[model samples]
Target: MGISRRATAHWEGDLKTGKGQLSTPQSGLLDNTRYAFSSRFGDEKGTNPEELIAAAHAGCFTMALSAKLTEAGFPPEALDTEAQVDLSMEGGPQLSQITLKVKAKVPGIEAEKFRAIADDAKQNCPVSKALSAVPVALEAELL
Candidate 1:
């Protein structure tokens, strides 16, 4: 079975001054949510595509790590993952780098084993796979 998800983005006007709205009708997390150039590039506080990608990557990787750990007989007590997306604007807008930092709490798991599993999750997570064109770095810590 193939599962599909959808999100819609609506924009009006030009790139620099245009206003956009994004909605995830299935989840209802965003309903005509606002996005503007200022939000994306300036100091305005609002959700942008990069920020959303970071959130998605972090959530996906953490869940993937938990599943992999469970499969390895070392289920994690807790996992915290942070994904950072760097967008380069020199030639044009491009995703330059993505870094994933994960701290995991698991009992009886050696550092080498945990690192290997975490790297596996980072490489195999859906979001990571989707963004394979971009460079991704993973730093995993076992606590």
Candidate 2:
């Protein structure tokens, strides 16, 4: 069976100055959280889709890296991943690329081996798979 998660959004008014709210019933992590055109396109302070996508990608990649390390018997002591989603508007608004920066501390694992696992996780994580159309670049460090 496939696991399913859900979030909902409500928007009012036109695209440029419209206001929106996003919510996830199960987690309530985004309970009526605000989003707006300025927030998405300008420097206004509010959540945007790309930011949310970056967060999800970071989380998914981190977990995937942990799984790979555990499977290889490395079992990382700690892993931190940050994903940056770049939006472009040359033709139209679209996600152009995603960059993942990962830092890991895994006892007794060689740097080369850890790099290979990190690359694999970046390529095969669920969020990476879902966003496969967009380019993904990874910078991994073993600490």
Candidate 3:
């Protein structure tokens, strides 16, 4: 089993005018000083939900693509995934769109096949599952 990770956040004052600290139990880099709050959701340098979602998308897509590539007998030499989450003020706090881009280097694999595999990963990654309410677009390339 993988090791568990923990992060804690502390907030002072109200949600809009308050400040907060985000810390990780195991990493000093996530110390209280690393996070702050501002009028923007009561945070200054602290990351918000959208940033977290984009990070999740990047991680999930990379792992899913790796697994899919291995299962297809063309394990990737390297897989780079990035996600851009767009938060538009349509009606509520909604994820307007997500753009996923992946660049993969897999020996002995055709570009089209690699792109298809990445597409499948995009559709089935855990982040994708968790974000069914949002629309996700993909731009996959194999090098």
TM-scores for the candidates? 0.96, 0.98, 0.81
**Model 3 C-alpha lDDT per residue in residues 1-143, reported as the tens digit of each score:** 88666888788876566667777779776677433335234445567667778988999999999999999999889988889998886796678999998888899998888888888998999789989899999998887
Superpose all Cα atoms of candidate 1 onto the true structure and report the RMSD in Å to 1 decimal. Answer: 0.9
Q: Sum up the clashes in candidate 1.
A: 0
Q: Between 2 and 3, whose lDDT is larger?
A: 2
Report the number of the highest-lDDT candidate.
2
Clash count, candidate 3? 6
The residue pairs found clashing in candidate 2 are none
Model 3, which residues run further than 4 Å from truth?
A: 1-6, 26-29, 33-44
Candidate 2 vs. true structure, TM-score: 0.98
lDDT of 2 by residue, 1-143 (tens): 99989999999999997899999998989999999999999989899999999999999999999999999999999998889999999899999999999988899999999999999999999999999999999999988
Query: Each model's C-alpha lDDT?
Result: 0.93, 0.95, 0.82
- TM-score winner, 1 or 3: 1
Cα lDDT tens digits, model 1, 48-128, are 999999999999999999999999999889998889999999899999999999988999999999999998999999999
Clashes of each: 0, 0, 6
Best by the TM-score measure: 2
- What would you estimate as the lDDT of candidate 2? 0.95
